[model samples]
Target: MKNTYITHALFMAMAASAFAVPSLAQETNAVADQADSGGLEEIVVSARRRNETVQDTPVAVTAISPSQLEASAALTIGDLQGAAPNVLITSAGTGAAAANISIRGIAFADIEKSFDPAVGVNIDGVYIGTSTGQMLDFFDIGSIEILRGPQGTLFGRNTIAGVVNIKRSRPTGEFGGKFEASYGSYDQMGLRGVLNVPVIKDVLAAKFFAFHNESDGYYKTVGTGQRRGGSNNENFGASFLFTPGDRFESLLTFDKQVQDFDPILGPLSRTGDAFAGALPAEFVDGNNTDNVYRVVAPSQQMVGTYSSPGVTNEMNLDLDVVKLTSVTAYRESDDQLRQDYSTTGLYFADRDQQYKQFSQELRASGKLFDGFDYVAGVYYFNSRYHIDQFTSVFFGAPTHQDTTGWSKSYAGFVDFNWEVMDKVRISGGGRYTYDKKKLQTAFTDPSNAGASFTGDKNSECWKKFTPKLGVDYRPNEDLMVYGSWSRGYRSGGFNGRGLTPFASALPYDPETVDAYEIGLKSEFFDRRLTLNLAAFYSDYQDIQQTTTVSVPGVALPQTIVSNAANAKIKGLEADFSAKPMDRLTVRGSVGYTDSKFKGFIVNQPVATGPTTSISRSFDFSAVDMIYAPKITASINAEYKLPLGPGDLKLNAGYRYLSRYDQQISADPALYPTALASAPTDIITVAQNDPRLRSDAQNLLDASVSYVFSLDNGLNYRLTGYVRNLLDDRGTNTSFVASNFPVYWGFATAREPRVFGVQLGVDF
Candidate 1:
């Protein structure tokens, strides 16, 4: 079946290319001239760390421009969900400002500073180390590029999946500014402004921007009628561009972001009636319902705060034949939150964390010979963090834990592209990376006077050499075919949620993937139509799996990370854009993924008595991978009409996603041995947990805008937009606790339908 699918996909792609040539020949000269005058807009990107048209780049990537963002009403990073193929981005339920990003079935959703992300998010050439503060608001953005598959050679560590490269707008050396304001549903309000000045015309320039947005949450408490989920976000930044001479240039940037919000944790326990006997009627009255917005409230309100400040400096020098570049960056973050899990106030946690990081990179790129070019670089990074947490559960007294960790990494990489033939090119590169990490932890229990202990400090290191090879064939200016093989690696780390000394000090092994891909890029009818397709297969090894497990003599379950599985993943992607008429444009994409576990072996813990437990080996290959949907597709269209001294534009989009699982340990066999057998209700509820699966979803959005200019040399635009037009609200994230009395689960709701109006002016 898999072979047939691949064959059909390739045949269709070739057939489309063949069909395009004849169609172009049949067009009349008048139609050809019309197409030449009004065709699809050209897109230029920096996917390879250099400027090139999207059709010329060999890598499989999607570039979103500022105009596209405005048409889609994309205010935050999470709004980029359906803009690319085989990519999923969402908010982490546990953290207010965190992003849970997945690419090609590889994902990481936890909010731990110690663990690294599979997908890399790079902002202006600086890689973000942690998931915290990654879901940034969009303000003065130049461009966004999503690269699919492994990019290990050029983009170094933790790029096992791919990279989301974001570039901000630079100083234009002009005296100009822009301002905007908005109001929306749920009492939402937003304001944004940007200013650019030529400090020393032709020599230096400065740019500044600020953004603020707030909303009165959509969800409401059952009895108190209070808002459950809402947020107030702000961002401020400045940039300075200096060009002392023709040979040297420098850009310095500084930014700060703040997020204050309340998260909604709805109870969806299957055994709600069982809890009714012990808790008040209001607490369990509406539990286990399909609606996600109305939930029981705890005695104390849930609140969270996240703040981050960062600075970056990039300098470039041109020596005629060689261009040298250096980038220096530093960032710091602070996060604090108080969470209520049980809804009845029986289970809750309070956490505070601080993190700091510094990095330096130097590289040189230039033409080596007549038909050859090379790029080489060396990078160094250092980061440290501390976390303090307090927890209270139904079966045990309150406990406090403190953790501290640090990591250092060094890497050297080089890449080259050589034109060996008239119409052929070969490219290859390699990277060598060395990483070291250290961790220390302490735990205390107030109920047990002598249960306090400090874990032994531990350290570990890992090293790897990854390589890539590719060949490209350009038959003509409008046609290209490419194939490549690459290897990617992710570093190892200790579990930050470990409750015991043994688990806290043990480190997991690294994860790696070997990927093979083939793709085609083409344009037809005088650049009026564009199409691209890609097929890829990967071998994943030493997979890192995080799971909750019961421990002897501990009242609550503990979380552990281990290298426990091997897998195979394969996928197909297609992207197309067309300008059928003078004022109409259409764009669409389709993505399909097939991922399966080859071997999954875990050490399952079985309770032998009230205070003792034993471990046994279990095979869980029957379980499905999380967030690996079989099919995802989207289509968007825009139409422009000339009005009285202005242009009126209308836009609409639709997205579809297949059902998939959201939890790792959802197999029935593991539940029997992993949880206690008493209360019979616990076993029944575990078998039929609704939080384990996410249903299929279909989303729709629309927007309308009008633009005009006045005699006073001013430009104005007014826009009205609606997202989630059909109001298809589904669970964004859901999970069942692993601790004792596992009869309940928690879930977070996706945003409901939102409508707003915005006005902008430029002078």
Candidate 2:
């Protein structure tokens, strides 16, 4: 292990030297112009609800521009896996529209609407309440800002990890449009168009965009040859900017997206386990090999469909002394999924869900004194959801479950920044949040004479006051040092996936984190080299862990949520960018995280005999946290060459991630014992199971483009890109189900090598 760490360190150092800088571009300008100037351009960001240069923000943030996104071929949110430090984003496996996002060791992957994500995703200043439809496609985007660390004060609830703020391009009040088409591996095809028009000159401008993409899938089922991991997606949106006058402005935007796809699931059957004799022969024979792209199942294909519609209105009024802002938004989503979990095709499940949310925010910002600026806001959010699920286990009669839930949240926050001295500044903020949740569930079993049970409606409320304080000292024009401390909160909720009434009605406590961070931002070598570094430690308390527990009179273990652990997470991040020459630019970043559970005690069901069981407390404090990779690094380089009538651009990127635990109960010993005389070899084999761990991975991508213009004021570009150049098909996530009759698991693999070409025109 020590040798492996040393090797990784050396590789990172070499990659940094070879690449040299950050690839993210300035928000409002072209990077090529900056390269020509022989110095890095200042990046502007809105991390603090105001426009400020990144170097002056005193926060750890990375801003990605539209040109950078295009260069990296980031078509969707999941494509931004290694673009930032200490962040991970991937498909959730439940559906194509869902995402599992982790920032700085904090993550949540379940699809249950009752559960809240530690990280927040905001679009055009409107927060997405659920992870179900957060994997948004990229189109007509202006900027993407990744704020690392707790954003409790300004972002309010459930931002204990961080926030991804996406800003769409506003109407330009010009008559212009762009169209593009692309074709890639696996028969993938895409088309996109954007149009901008002035509704009324100097008063209103409108922008409209439409996009469509389809693919034939990467994996196939054994015997049937049914496709999996395929998707057909469509998205369209329109935004109208109403200026009316210089003192007031309003923007209204509407968007809708639809996804039709197949869920991805790779079965990993344990044929050598203690209960192997009880397993279906089909399962054992079908998954005898270790190929993640092929599976044995009875179903023709699993189906997943999702659709969401949303509308937002943002109005601003600028007074002489203060500026007032109001944001109102509403969104609705419908999701359907059919999956085969047992891999035998005989055991399958179906889910239908509907969700809706509404939010309103009012804020005011202005200079409060000679050196002080303040921003204050009041926010309200309400959401409701319903789910109907049916499952058939081990070829048994299907069971039905229905869940309904709602949440309401209210918050008040204030933040202020004061330059007390010439080179010293102080910032402080706080937010008080009150959240209320209600849940009800019903279950019916057909095998038990159609027995039905309904859980009583349960309601719960939680309140929290989170605060932040920071100070920064700038001793020179090109250098600044800052330190900060903050607290973040996530609300409590009932278990919506519970199989029994008692478990469904049970409530879990809220989770909170206290974080401390210090950082330095600097530039050297005549502004040609920029380096930023940060180190942070976070204390996580009352972690809401989702686990399985045995319920009396139930054949299968019930999924439950509990505040079962506390943790300590510390990390270091470094980012640098350099203009090595006039035509070549290099960017690189490295992140190191050390996450460990401080206290993890949970009750497990131990089988003493064939028909008897007992619950015992187990200490699992030594286990590693899920999705907490120890080391993550990336290097990217871009070179520009003057062609005959245009500029030729070549880009390459490499990303690396160390092995990390993908499941909470990764240790085989944490599994419930079958019996005292169980075969020891089965346990030993399970201990070395490769399906329980996500191995280290290295990925490479490259792209080339040629841009030119015609004399008629028309612009054209041609590009070729390839992702996963090395075809590293490592496990992205693993799901272990040891509480079942046998030790079985399923895993999702990273995307394979894909190459494509694209053509675009602007008129």
- Candidate with maximal lDDT: 2
lDDT of 1 at 454: 94
Cα lDDT tens digits, model 1, 1-763, are 2322332343334333323433222211111111223777678887777778889888899987776777777788888886788888877778757887888888777879998888888988998898888887775788899998877777545489899998888887766666677899888887777766689988999987777778888878777887768888877778999998999999999988888888667665544322345544544434332455777777666778888989999999999899999999999998888887644666678889999999899999999998898889998889999999987766357798899999999999988889999889998898898999999999997876455679987899999999999999999999999999999899998888887887898999889999999999999998889999999998989988887766766655788899988889999999988988887888899899999886776665655555676555555565667777788888988888889977788999998878766767544334444454433222221222345666777889899999776655556789999988988877777776653334356677777899999887655
Clashing pairs in 2: 21-576, 21-577, 21-586, 21-587, 21-588, 22-577, 22-587
For each candidate, what TM-score against the reference?
Answer: 0.91, 0.92
Where does the lowest 10-residue lDDT sum fall in candidate 2? Answer: 21-30
- lDDT by residue (tens digit), candidate 2, 148-201: 998987753549999999888888786666667789998888777776667999
Candidate 1, poorest ten consecutive residues by summed lDDT: 25-34
| Residue 684, candidate 1: C-alpha displacement in angstroms | 17
State the local distance difference test value for candidate 2.
0.79
Query: Highest TM-score, which number?
Result: 2
